[model samples]
Every structure is written in C-alpha cells, then in structure tokens.
Target: MARLLYELCGIEDALRFSPFCWRIRYALAHKGLEAETRPWRFTEKEALAFARHDKVPVLVDGDEVVTDSYNIMRYLDHHYPEAPLLGEGMAETRARFFNHYAERTLAPAILRIIMKDLLCAIHPADRAYFRRNREKRLGCTLEAFHAPAQGLDQLNAALEPLRGQLKTSPFLDGQAPAGADYLLFGHFMWARCASNADLLAESDPVHDWHARMLDLHGGLGRNARRIRDVGAV
Candidate 1:
C-alpha cells in the first residue's frame, strides 16, 4: 500500500498552484514523509469520488483516506509524531487560527491579485468551470475581479499581524517552522505559482519569512514549477 496525495495542478501537470494542496506538501516534507502526488485538475471531481470529496489535497495513506488540507495535517501529525506539526494545547489552537486566516483573509487577497493569471494558467478544459464557479461566488467576472493594485494593498494590510509576530521571531511558530508557518506559506506559494505580480515588498518581515520558507524542505516551494516556467504566464 503506497501513500498517495491528489493535488491540484494547472495547464501543465507540474504547475501545481493550489494553496490548500501546498499546505499538505509542506506538511509532508516537514514530517520527513513522502507521498506520490497525482496532478488533478479543477474539472476532475470524479477522480476524487473514492475519497467522497470533490477537492484536492486528498491524502490516501495505506488503508486510510483523508480529505481537506487541515485534516490531512492533523492526520499526518497523529500517524507520524516524530516531527509534530500541530503542537499541543494553545499552540495547536493558534495553528488552527492561522489556517482560517490563510483561507479567509490571505487567500482572497492573493486571489484578487492573481485571478486573471490563474485563469490563464489553469487547463483549457477547466477554464470555463473555473470562471463560472468563481464569478458566481465572487459576483464578478475574472477581469473585474483582478485588481492587483488594490489587492496588493489589501494583502499587505492583512499581513500586518503576521509581520508584527515575525518581527520578534524568525518563524511563525517560534524558533522553528511549524503548522502555522506552513498554513500562511501555502497562500504565498499560490501567488508565486499563479502570477508574476510582486505581492510583498523586500523590506517587510513577512517577505523575509517567505524567503526562508521557500528554502525549506530542500527548496520544495522554490523549486516548484511556476506558470511562467510552463509558458502559461
């Protein structure tokens, strides 16, 4: 029985841009674990029927099946406790807050900045599905949704809390990188892979933390295939 992870990819199989999936990718690396990743497109919901979920970041570990990024993180930490991700007590609670912050605050800001580029980066077959669903949810077309200038401002504002925290410590989770670090890092990876826009200024502490994150786990995020690498951007 092999460990398998189904993650979302773009036009090219190597161009994985989903922030949720990236969280699991970093989590697996942090645990010193490896799983064969299968590239899944937006329109390939049927492929995940076995997991009873229509989303990426679905992990199949031996006889166990886990859906959703946060659940997968907890599953990995429980199964492989050697390198714990979600710490005990308050630490774990804080990590969960980071997860929500990434999903609710950070992700939307980044999406607003990169929606157009992301649309172009996704597979042609998924374009219609992506645009339709996103427009309905956002109540605006992709073109109208893209506001890099405003988005960047919103992104920076949303990151102020993290920036203040990082000012005192090197990583989000104190001395070492933990689940909280990965939670936020995933959103930045989404922006990096999908668009060429510069979301962070060089002087920001969050930007410095992001650089350190990219170099983690043998440069997993840094070496990931970007849209530009596939000539999508």
Candidate 2:
C-alpha cells in the first residue's frame, strides 16, 4: 500500500477554512490508508503556492499532485478498491450527490455570512487584506459576496434534506462514514464555530445530523482546533 502525503491549508474560522480539505483527510483516515497529514497556515505566499501550484487538499501519491476532494476520492476509489469510499450502487450515488450538493449549494451560505458580516466587521485596515485573500481562493469578486443574504437562506434550505437523511443512516452514505460523510464534515465546518461563539445558532436536521457525523468522525476538523478543550462535532 502506498502511504499518501496530504497537504492541507488550515483555517479554523470563516468560509475559507478548509472543510473541503478536511473531507480529504477524513476519507484518508476512513480508508485505513497510511498517510501523513501536514497542516499548513494562511499567508499570501501560501495562497499563491496552492493556487499557482494547483491548490490543496493536494494528495501526493509518490510525485503525483492530486487535488480536489471529489477527484481525490475518485482516485482513491480507483486505487484502493478494498474498503471502497463509495459503496455498491445506490449508496455510492447518494454519497456523490451529497458531496456535490454540499459544494454547489450548502457552502455559499456559511461563506456569505463570513464574508459580509464577519469580514466587514473587522477593522477597516484589515478588511481589504481579508477580501483579497478570499477572492484569490474563490476566484470571484469580493463585491459579489457583499450580500451574503442570498447564500444564507439557500444553505439552510439545502441542509434540510440532511436532517431526514441522518435519521436513517449514521453516516451520510449509510452504515459507514463514506465519502459523503467526509464532504459533510467540510461543509458544516464554519457554522459549527458560530454556535459555539453564540454569534448565532442553527436548528433541526442540520444540528442533529451534525451531532451524528461528529460523533462518528470525532469532529469537523476545520473548527475543531478552536475548541477550548475539545468538541464533539
């Protein structure tokens, strides 16, 4: 078995935090694949490295630079076919759906809140720096995120389906914490901190599902570092 070298850009707060990166970590752990995790920090130089050098959650299998969560999962599936990340059929499809849904739909809400409310609330001197870094990672105009309102409601709504899903399976894909579970871990990373800080809280299937996922995987890694001591999910 080839032990993979995983490079992650660690950010504990805000939307830029690497929940997506965490998904890859969780998948590596779940697959029982031997690997080393190197936690990287934020800096313009670091951001430039990932962007210019193909960005992160960059999985190094020997010399190959494998990036993107779904793409990495696919690579893993192809190579390590034993404990498959995607199960047989319908289950695998569901995991894929959840992964895409989280990236496409759920992520923007938390991002919007972080961008408009949180970032702007920082000192005026720091906001420009913050916006510049965010735009680099997201490849979008900071002005677009000036209104996080649109992203907020949609995030909550997208999360509604998960509440019902969690009621049935401990993991998003079913009995095992498959690829979707890892993806969800990343998606929920930002909001987890907010509830803890008492800035705001979320309700329902979202909370419950988070509980189950956290219980299974320990906790979402993105916000886990901020724990005064430790956090469950």
Candidate 3:
C-alpha cells in the first residue's frame, strides 16, 4: 500500500484503540481512501523515530509523513480534495474550533472517567511506562484518581455542550457530519474500545449521535476491535 497508518494498540495487534488514530481512520473512510493500519504500542517509541515524532496516528503516504490527528485530517483533505472533510468558506474555521474543543475539553473529561480502565487495556509491556508517566502528569496514582461513583455526573456535565448541539441537529455540523463530528467521535470511540463503563444515558442526544457515527461508512468505527468487555458493536 502506498498509504499506511501507524496506530496505537494493546497486546493484540488487531486491538487498535487510539482516539487520534480513530479520527484518522474515520477521516480515511469518509474520503473513501484505503490505508494499511500498523499497530504500535507505547513502549515502542523507537518504531516511530523515522517520523521524528513520538506518537501514534502517523500517516505515511509514500514520501509524505504526517503526525497529529488534526494535521492528518488536514493533510488528507488537502491532498485528496475529493470528498472534503471541512467544507468551504468558514467551515474549516468552525471545524478547527470543534477539534480544539474535543482535544482540550472532551478528551480530558473522558480521560478522568476512564484512566484506570485505559491502564488495564494497554499492552503489558507498556504498563510500567504508562503508569509512571501518567501518574506524574496527573499527580496521583491511577487507583487513587477515581472520578467519583460511576463518574457519570462528571461525564454528563462535560457533554452538556454536545447534548445541546445535538438537540439542534443530527450531527455537530448542522445537517451532516464533518470534521467536528469526527473530532468528538474519536473520544467516544476511545472509551468504547478501552472501557466497559457506559458513559452516556440511553436517552441522551449525544448517545444517539454516537450510534449514528458507529453506523457510518459501512460501520468502519463500529467494526473496530475493542477490549472483550467493550468490543465494537
């Protein structure tokens, strides 16, 4: 394949569950592009040295190398220019805002609720490294950082903005999904692949949007490999 995507995974090479990677995966499917996915783990930074970046979701399109989820999305849309991820005019600007919202607001909130669950889902080789680095960043041990009884209240509170938006339309981008929808979907996909806990109420509009995301592009996101308890439906 001329195009390849290196993604974060657990013990099983098929169990790719990186939120950033999921964004790229969804973007690729949205553009009707096919790229072979390569599984990478946290302890394997050396594997990505060729890209000069220490992260997963690295896109290798022949000689072109792109890192970071947002950048990768832009690269795909720029290079392909067929099925656009962000529409013209101010659409790109609006998508960028939602991308920032997902990375800054949504991701941190989801991490708090699933940090411990994520630890259990990583490769065994990555356990010590992940724990040490994350604990230092969080200023507490994983076990000590519980998000308070089910963490649903905190998660729901963080999702209020999305809930409100969903009530107005079927997706973040008025009539149909665009970059903003994929941006936020990545985090929910992360939780679905890494944890067993139900993060949304059945009646929540955000939950409904998630279901629609899962069903997009012939269920590309829905068919991904997840942990046993939270496997993709």
Best model number under TM-score: 1
RMSD in Å for all candidates: 1.1, 5.7, 2.5
TM-scores of the models, in the given order?
A: 0.97, 0.68, 0.93
Ranking by TM-score: 1, 3, 2
lDDT of 2 at 197: 28
Name the 10 consecutive residues with the lowest summed lDDT in model 2.
Answer: 192-201
Using TM-score as the measure, name the better of candidate 1 and candidate 3: 1
lDDT of 3 by residue, 79-165 (tens): 999878876579887888888888878777788788877888898899999999978987998877767354566677778888888
Cα error, candidate 2, residue 19 (Å):
1.8
Candidate 1 vs candidate 2: the TM-score winner is 1
Assess candidate 2 and give its TM-score to the true structure.
Answer: 0.68
| Segments in model 2 whose C-alpha atoms lie over 4 Å from true places | 1-16, 41-52, 87-94, 116-130, 133-152, 193-203, 217-223, 227-233
Q: Alpha-carbon error at 68 in model 3, in Å?
A: 0.5
lDDT of all predictions, in order shown? 0.90, 0.60, 0.85
Worst 10 residues of 3 by lDDT: 224-233
Clashing pairs in 3: none
Q: How much lDDT does candidate 1 score?
A: 0.90
